[model samples]
Target: MTTPLLMLLILTLPLLANRLVGRTAAPAATEAAAAWGLGLVFLFTASGHFVQAEAMTQMLPPWVPLRLALVHATGVLEIAIALGLFTRRWRTAAAFAAATVLIAFFPANVYAALQHAPMGGHAWGPVYLLVRAPLQLILLGWTWGFLLRGRTPKRMPSRA
Candidate 1:
């Protein structure tokens, strides 16, 4: 829903801006857009950790400890990772960290959907997975395609 739309908008806007400016090369612009877009997405989701703290806490099983603390910690992590994506030196590591975080948090999404945790759209029940799962895959693909892929490897020295 909103998440996907935000992702799409943020992902494209940079490229559009670049097109208008006609300054940066296309490939570099594309990479910049991707990183900026994904980083913003993480920041967006991280805000939910505080804005919807109780619902987020409920997403976890009762057996889990320090749910609120965990939510806040993850929020912080997302913010840090998002910032890291902005720098060339840290972009790859940030993308990898973002992917890892997404994978780690997915089960909580499943738990929330199953329990009908009364958060955004989770009330739709198991059917929600149909949408959620695909979105998760898309995020992972976005991370890989944009940040992880196309990295140039070091060349071996040529013998004379």
Candidate 2:
């Protein structure tokens, strides 16, 4: 339920991106990318809720071998990054944070794939590991390019 809603939100982001980029070409694609990237970050967090939906209404995936304290920390970071993405001043920072988080979660994806963990009875576990594992790195690069490169103003201040 939440996953679909988050996916819808992600798909709608391009519309928001178009409007945001139209306002100023300086941030331009970078801002849109940041928004899109941030949306994914939110979507990723939402997906985790699906993984552990049975135990609690909203909770981390129990399969993950991490302390409760670490899980809470991750939740805090996700919310903070989500908030950061909402404003222009923090957009780039949000992108960076989201990218970092994505990279950090790669191992779990890999483990799931390798372990052949059954998700929703759709088992292609190892295949998923091979396919999606690389995606994390690619997304990191895309966000880095979109946010870091796009955010940089093309014109340097003219030295008199």
Candidate 3:
């Protein structure tokens, strides 16, 4: 299937399922749903890293070392992050790491746009990158807000 369609599916499937199960359309519920949705996105993208290695490597700039290896390693990281999101464990660290990962990969997106990299047989242009960049920021914010909300401080136990 095409990348855009796959992306739409990855992003919306979870949210749709959440609502179908009778979840409200409130912001908090939406954020929780998005955690699952974006987790699926990460897993899907990670699989592409391995399954479509050639296309993924094409997105990397020349300066990156061992492009193929980096692609696979990142796939592994994405899997771990996705699992963490689903389980709702390791919240602060996972959110921070996932946000950092997205920021770190922005350069590859820029390079791909500049190089006119083709994915699924269509060349990506500046307009594509323009649309994509903000999505990264939105993902970063989602990671932070959805996973890092309502911090609970450590406190000593009261004497019995």
Candidate 4:
């Protein structure tokens, strides 16, 4: 709930600010805002890895090896993806990376939901999937719509 709201706020506030300043024609501003917003979302989620390490570890299935280490590694990866999104050179790659990470982590979410893991929202039980699944899809769509799709590579000049 709060996460989605935060993402929306971060993504929209910049556009609103730009509009106030009369920078309406700049699509780059929109893209920058989206990237920054998504980056912040990742940073926020990553904080949970360290701040609630025990609860986060419970999100994983027992079969998963080195769950705590995996959680910490993913936290680092999210931080990296967040930083990468801030740069034009890496934005697309970071978006793709983010999408992959989102997909990769989803099964754990499902597991946690079904198991009613005693974490933040997961404790809500299997019904939590009702919210989590769509949120996951929305995040994926955001990555694609704002960061990945329609970005063509710049053509080099002809030697002629």
Candidate 5:
């Protein structure tokens, strides 16, 4: 629900600010802005790994051991991804990697929902899964859109 909206807002904030300032920003600026925004989101989410360890652990598949350790590792990965997104050299790779991580985590979300495992005090149900599934796709598309789809703007020859 709010995830997509937040992503959209994050995606557009740079361009919106540019417009407000009577300046037209490059399209890549919007993409960069989105990258930065997503980085922050991941960082915030990573905090929950420690803050709600027991509940997060319950969402894990039984075969997985050292639940808290796994959670913390994912948090570290999220933090690394966030930092990577902030770097011009790493944004594209980071975006692609972020999408991969998001996809990898999708199964846990499904498993959690199907089990109706409540984490952070919120109950999970079919309705939540319904929204989450499509949201995953959207998140992937958004990641790809900003980083993978666009061509770099061509520079014109400068005249003397």
Candidate 6:
């Protein structure tokens, strides 16, 4: 219900999935977790964008429509990526795509933090943007690592 609790769900879903993966052969739980996590992440980000839209318009040098459209589109993409990640066939691709999305959104986040965008006059404006941007990147990397490890052989340098 609250943003923090929702965030905790977003953060923990993947770990739960990993545990579920060990118990079940199909990894259905893992996929479900990814889907749910991403969906919530998407919803939260979109809502935040609107909450800070007025400040966004003023702070961004870019066109307002373009900025708004991009942010909204990103939310849709997040949901889509989550769905894709949950599918048996698209998990790998989705992981990479999700990482890409996180990377792409970094700029808007930085701008928001730098400008101290008013989240409807909320005091934690800068803190919210600052924390989420880096955390998103880290999470993306973590997801990537999760998707890659043990699936491919790592190369070791020869000892001469």
Candidate number achieving the greatest TM-score relative to the actual structure: 4
lDDT of 6 by residue, 67-99 (tens): 666555655676677676667567666666767
What is the overall TM-score of model 4 with all chains considered together? 0.87
TM-score of 1: 0.85
Question: Candidate 1 lDDT, tens digit per residue, 14-104?
Answer: 6577667876666666777788888888888889999998889989999999999998999999999999888777887888898899899
Which is the winner by TM-score between candidate 2 and candidate 6? Answer: 6
List ranges where model 2 is wrong by over 4 Å.
1-26, 33-37, 50-69, 120-123, 150-160
Candidate 6 achieves a global lDDT of 0.60
lDDT of 3 by residue, 15-129 (tens): 7998899988887677667778778888888888889888888888778899999889999999988887776455445566678799988888887877778754226567776
1-160, model 2: which lDDT tens digit per residue? 2433454466456646766667544555546655665566565664454444342211235555554556556666777777776666777777777777878866655655555555421146666655565555555665676666555424446899
Instruction: Report the Cα lDDT for residue 109, model 1.
Output: 89
Point out where model 6 deviates above 4 Å. Answer: 1-5, 17-40, 43-59, 63-65, 120-130, 150-160
- As for TM-score, the candidate ahead, 3 or 5, is 5
The clash count for each model shown is 0, 0, 0, 0, 0, 0
Instruction: Write down the worst ten-residue block by lDDT for model 1.
Output: 147-156
lDDT of 4 by residue, 1-160 (tens): 4655676676556556766887765778878878887898888889999998889999998998999999899999999999998888889888889999999999999999889998878988889888888888988998888788986545568999
RMSD (CA, Å), candidate 5 to true, equals 7.1
Predictions in order: lDDT:
0.82, 0.58, 0.75, 0.84, 0.73, 0.60
For residue 73, model 1's alpha carbon misses the true position, in angstroms, by: 0.4
What is the total number of backbone clashes in candidate 2? 0
Model 1 collision count: 0
lDDT of 6 at 67: 67
Candidate 5 residue lDDT tens string, 22-105: 754677677776677677767766777878777888778888999889988998898888898888887877777788898999
Please report the TM-score between candidate 5 and the true structure.
Answer: 0.79
Candidate 2 TM-score, true structure as reference:
0.60
TM-scores, each model vs. reference: 0.85, 0.60, 0.77, 0.87, 0.79, 0.63
